[model samples]
Target: MAVKEFKLPDVGEGVAEGELVSWLVAPGDRVEEDQPVAEVETDKALVEVPSSYDGTVEELFVEEGEMVPVGDVIISFRVDEEGEADETGEADAVDEAGDETAAAAESEAAADEASAEPGTADAEPEPAAADAEPETPSGRTFAPPSARRLARELGVDLAAVDGSGPGGRVTEADVRAHAAGDAGGADAGGAESDEAPAPTPTDVGSGDRKSAVRKRGEDGSGDAPEPAGRDTTLATPATRKLARDRGVDVDDVPTDETRDGEAFVTGEHVRAYADALESAAATASTGGGSAEPTPEPEPVDVGADAEPAASDAAGDAEPAPAGATEAGGDETSAPESGDETVPYRGVRRTIGKQMERSKFTAPHVTHHDTAEVDALVAAREELKPTAAERGVKLTYMPFVMKAIVAGLKEHPYLNSELREDEEEIVLKKEYNLGIAVATDAGLMVPVVDDVDEKGLFELAEEVRDLAARARDRSLKPAEMKGGTFTVTNFGAVGGEFATPIINYPETAILGLGAIEERPVVRERDGTSEVVPAPTLPLSLSIDHRVVDGAVAAEFANTVMEHLETPLLLLNE
Candidate 1:
């Protein structure tokens, strides 16, 4: 049999190392190609690594909780053929060496070993020391080094009699199972250990010492501990400093009693204390004491350009010219200027970088259109009750998606992306529309694959599932990639119209605004009547370098027309 070493792959942009959070398969377990072997945690996200080949796991090079650098062998597999080893190794070595030429092969191997075993370096020193003994806590023995370290970290006594590893040796798996059982209250002994400490009663009438005093003596007490000072009261460091500088006694600041070990003191407590102190001072000032001193306002200095203009009479300088005064006011009212700081991590950061690259590389243009969707609204209201009864809540988004798909069929250029470096444009035949979903963490665009092939109901179901997963942060990396075009619904947040930034690499992004009832003039033969119609405001942001302004406007108008009629979308 051939042993194939699987090195950790580069999952995202410039990720150096990833922590092995979980192992899906143990040594000797059979795995299929594309099956998840381990879950790894990078700086940005947690991702599952899949097996590249079908084989039996011969050895694990890394242990959970240990971090391994990219290009390090994490696991070895026993494969069916020996001939394929040379070819696989050469290709894998080339792929791993990309963008990481400085890392030596031996260093890579050492990283792999470290990933397979946590604290491997620290485990060797004790074996060489003559007087060193195995420091297994009284009760548990026969545990592997990894298991022993895990137990110590988790506060588990290793002397317990259960073992699940080969030859009755305790493993990390066993420790984890025990921890799970303890958490679930499945063990009565473990539950007893979790009980609260009993209270001690003080002796009343007798001259006997308290149990605490006796316990303190038994514990070998030295000098008495210092009493905590008034700094324990509720207030931020800034607030405390301000009070101290103003000669305010913090002890006089009344605060509500908090539970022992609580991490925070409420802001209400500080405000109440401040209000009480202010009231007392006001009363003292009103009761014939010296009045509160008035503070002087700081003076402003205008620049030379903003100085008073020369007057004809040379006396008043023409009252500093109206424009100079206005200019000074504008400078004072100007918003605080600073760099817009954003974390270069997670989905939002990735999106920001991609957009920056796209905008700088490709020229952009935008188009706007309005659609009167009175019939579409009527159709949706007619279907809403039936859809609800069938456990589906129909929204305007699904209708808009259908209209967009129809428009793409007629004007396929909107679904194409340009490669500036290659000097070529790619026209995608398949319709994979990415629906931009906003979550608390960031924005994620999960593609609704093969949108042209799927029916409206199927599209709606897929959109719902992708949106829910995006919100919960359960979406995989693959779900957010490979999109021909993108759609973002700003209507949900009550926006009338907005120009959404184009999702990078994709040529364009369609923005949907709120559907409002607006007055429309309906003409019948020779007369016209004012009627309320459901109207939608839409904006399309496109790369002007790839597409012209007219083409962008045409595509948007096509989408709007299809949405307004609704029947055109169905037939298409």
Candidate 2:
């Protein structure tokens, strides 16, 4: 047998290191080549790492929650050589030697023995009995250090979980499963402390001391007394804090989830418990019997009525500094109880670093303008039916994209990246537009490649599809890379213009505003006439080091010309 070490590879995009999130395989388990064994987080994205060779997992070098650099050994495997005795052969040999000596007892112990590793399946019956000593029928437990740590963090009772690892050892999957079940119902109803027993001795750890001592009747048949604060609650540190913030006790929060003889509590339980308390308090104050439930909003056509929703999902604005003043110029103060602190890690940290680098490195100069896009609006109305028939939900974004591509054809500088290290400007021949999507987690930009070669209908479908995927966090790392230019539509949410930070390495970013109708003066037959016209707002931010003010103005003007005369886009 040969032992081989598996190192973490550079997944792509120059990722330096990744946080090990979870392992799909356990030690002693056989894995096939190219099978995913672990999930790693890099650049705020989760990606699975596959095995390089087919072998039995010997050990995991890095524990979950730890970060490992690329090229570092993360795991080791035991490879089987030709003509070598495999685990099955070893087990068979042991069974043949034992003959019928231990055969009768084996069937009765089958359930408990099933948890043993494959290599130990045919070991002497005495050793198998020795392995079962740690796990008692009364619910004692044995788990690896990593699994124990995760159980504590998740507030899970390891004793309640059935071990699936070698030698009856509890694994991470068991802890996660226990936690998920608890979150669903362990704290379902808001049961008061008076209704349930006080907190008692739980399997979490020896943090709180129990004072009660059990005493039996003279016959020694009475049930033992339960300990104080014995309720099983599964919650993270953050969830516990949230419960405290809302003045709810985790123990009092009732849940429905009870698996493996233990109940689990979640933040949702705490919130529901608190809300119920508040509602009861309000009803008592007003002398009302009951309060009515909050009404839900009526549904509307999202495409037309939900323009702001589009913008909210398109930009990730830098979070305001703590204690900053409000819009009314009133200085904000910390909460009386205490300031709620949130760690700026993951996507937020990545965004902050990128913003700092781009702002400091690139000298930004923004040019703002408005275009009379009455023709563009009219053209979209005319093509809307045909687009729908083609199974495309066409939006103004496609028109803007086509117009931007046309404008880039005239002003190639905006469609290029500036490499400061090489002191050279690299103009991209193929247009790949990066569209900024605002997700609940953070801002993501999914690139639409070869935009210059696609029609408006295709561009619309791709933009819509990418935005949906980005919001759901399903976009791959490759889909987000290789952008020549970027477009951010703040107007979808209601902004007229914004000085958008350039996507680093890219030279310019165009910010599109909401289309609005306003009064305008027009000349006809040498006479001036006042009429309402559709106006589209535009904000172009460029890298001033590479693009001049005249060039920026020309580019914006060309974009405006395309929008004002929609038919001109066909010629491009």
Candidate 3:
């Protein structure tokens, strides 16, 4: 037996450090090689860190929510090396392990992808074939729906299996390969020539439901009381939070799906249950003489108003700022009425730093305008059904994207970046546009490659797909990169004509305000009349260092022309 320390590997793209989100494995827990042990969030993504060697976890050095630098020893394992793979094989394992943030499948694939090294081109896997795969965004594994269902049926761990499908998706075939014990086929279908590891307590509902409480309690800490209906319910942490937020006991939600002999509860399940209760209450109220059952009282979180004392959670908690406490105080107290202190780290921190840099480093100028979009509106209505037939929802976004591309072509400065080190303005020929998506974590911009080549229906489908994944916190790092320009639709959330910020490095960003009916003067055949017309508001922001005020206004005009005339887009 030997003690081996597994350091936090550099999850590519030059990431120097990551904040430990949670420990998937605890001390004394047995973990297999390539099994995800912890989830770490870099500025780029939240990814699962896999164990490099198979062993009993001796101890974890880093606590939850702590920032750790690359190559720092995170966890130590007690391994019996007598029959283990050679040192060369372990090095290869280390490289494959750092591949992706266990990103969720793109709206349809599985919830696990390869660890953080982005881009499609993979370097040749080391000669050692049986060593590794990739792991997730948040804690959810990215696999297709079918692949997820299959893994549950086969009792296979998706975390241990490398994704072989597009965007590092773990397919059903890959699951089968792992189950069949053929580690030699890992690159093509993430597999290993060993029996599946027994289900650990960290994996909720993977075993007997009778062990529910014991299973969820990691180190006997942070475990809330399980409601009656929830005893046999299996759900992700996000799903549980959703249930709690909606005041629904997960146990009360009915699920027809069961994995490993336990009921599988999802966000959709909780929502449907909530809706049913609402309907029943309404029906009872209308009856006047009602006998419909009342829902059970929501479980009270006794610890909700209080955070753990600094003394109690010293290893995990960061020390209070000097001014945050009275002299010699050992804790940071809260208000009697329950004041919340959300951690200002992770994705939120990343957004702050990026915004700060852009605001301070570049001079910004915004150009706002509104185009009469009655023709654009009518054109969408005409083509909506055709798009629908192809299973796409035709929104005004695709038209706006097309218009932005046309504008970028006419004013190339809007699509160019200032290379300060080279002292040059770098112009890009490809039209990869990033569409800003509002997610639960924060705003993420998923780049749609080659916007100039895709048709309206294709754009609509792809945009919707990316947005869905973005909101669910499943977008890949690659999907978020390589944007020559960006578009933000504040209109979707009911905003109108606000100055938008440029997505720095890239020279500009186009903000779309709500399309509303407004009275405007129309001069036709020597007659003028004030008429209500649907107008789309546009706000274009540019870096003053790269694009001038006049040039920005000219680009906005080109965009408005395509939007107002509709048929003008054909000239592109």
Candidate 4:
């Protein structure tokens, strides 16, 4: 038999690494080729990594919650000459690397002894006390190094953790429970000698994702147990980061729905939790502010240029982010009497870096205009029944997408990407548009491939599906990549002619505002007549470095022309 190594494959295009979220298959488990062995959370999505070869899993090189880079060998498999999976698929869930290593070592020693003595095949080896938990002269708790490290990470005193392992040795699980503030305080157990060794940290599912945030009680008040990782909470890293940024514990975020047998927490859940905390605080301070909808703080703008705003008469309700300390000062920013410290990491940090690069690399310029869409509205109204017959909930977005595609055809530069390395502007002929779906505290832009070829209903269906999936963190990594242009409808929420950032690599992004009725003058029998018209506000932002102002204006005009004319989109 020989062993084959399997590396962490790239889950997303341009993705460098992913966090080893959890192992689906344990060591010694029979795995088929292309069998999903682990759940990895990459920058774009949480995906399952499949095994490359069929074999018995020999070892897992990385632990759960550890960030593993692409091309790094994460697992190994032992295969026979036939290159088939093991017939005996029995596995121990609690088994970790330490136990496996010790078992292998014992087997080797047994083979050596068998060669020396011909009749000792069925003999049991003598217990090795030295190899087991080494006894100390001092009365310190006999804990493994992994357990000690876990204790330090969880801020649990090893002395306070009750030992559950052989010979009263403290295990990582014991430390985890102690840190989670399990009922009944832990105390040192009387030492008892046993043959079996203690389980390692791999069994406990604790690795290098180190951070803490105090979880308040259900009603957002009173003493509560320390926050612990909820194995059931299945959220994208971005949603988790947003929770942390808002000073909310992700494990504590209440989730009702689940995806793939785990409680899936979205950005909406985190925002709701944070909002509830703020409201709870506000209600405590003011007699009955939270109950009134008017007193509830407006959801903060998450745009990059957004600034702190205290709209309430009471003022200063937003808690400042912790860990902000003066340079060289030993004192760090501390949370108030009822505050929590949250760590910023994961996809939020990833997006932040991308945005910073785009903003720094390309100078942005936004041109704002409005299109009279009275005819377009009537057309959509007429087509609504037809669209419904096809099982598509037709919306204004598809029309906007069609118009954007038409505009890109006229202004090819808008659909082009800037290649700084090659010093080339690659004009893309295929029209792939990104529809930015705004989550409660995060944003996702899932791309729709070949927008130019899709019909209105087809575009409508795909856009709807993509947007829904994006909000729920179900969007695939490929769906979020390879966009030539972007369309963000700030209108859906409530925005008018706001400047939007261009999606990096792509030259332009079009922002749509809320469609509203406005008074306008139009020619009637060669005389000007005042009339009410449904106007659609448009904001086109372009990379000033590559796309000139005149071209941007022309593109905006072309989009407006298609939107205003309505029938023009059918030809294109």
The model with the greatest TM-score is: 4
**Residues forming the 10-long window of minimal summed lDDT in candidate 2:** 204-213
TM-score of each: 0.49, 0.57, 0.57, 0.58
Candidate 3 residue-wise lDDT, 194-276, digit = tens: 22323221222111111111111122222122234446787655457556654466775666555567877655555444443
lDDT per residue as tens, model 4, 370-436: 9999989999999999999989999999999999888898889999999999999999999999998
Per-residue lDDT of candidate 1, residues 69-186 (tens digit): 7876677765666433321122232333242344324445423322111212243322222113211122124554356445533435444527877756678888887767665432
Task: Report the lDDT tens digits of candidate 2 across residue range 1-572.
Answer: 44566899987577877767788876556799999999887775667899999976655656665556677667766666574332222223223234343631464343333223232223344333334433222323546547754554444555567788767878889889887987633342423211222111121111111111111111121211111133566644545755555545566565644334565554445444444444343333344443332112122221221211111221221111122222221112334346654445555667789989999999999999999998999999999999999999979998888889988999999999888789899988989999999987588889999988888999999999999988876788899988999999998889788999999889999999989987888998999999888899899999999899899999999999999999988875
> Candidate 2: where are CA atoms >4 Å away?
1-5, 22-32, 53-64, 73-146, 150-346, 523-531
Give the Cα lDDT of each candidate.
0.58, 0.64, 0.65, 0.64
- For candidate 4, report its TM-score: 0.58
Clashing residue pairs found in predicted model 1: 61-116, 62-115, 62-116, 63-115, 63-116, 139-159, 140-158, 140-159, 363-544
What lDDT does candidate 3 reach at residue 167?
Answer: 55
- Least well predicted 10-residue stretch by lDDT in candidate 3: 205-214
All predictions: root-mean-square deviation over Cα?
21.0, 17.1, 19.7, 15.9
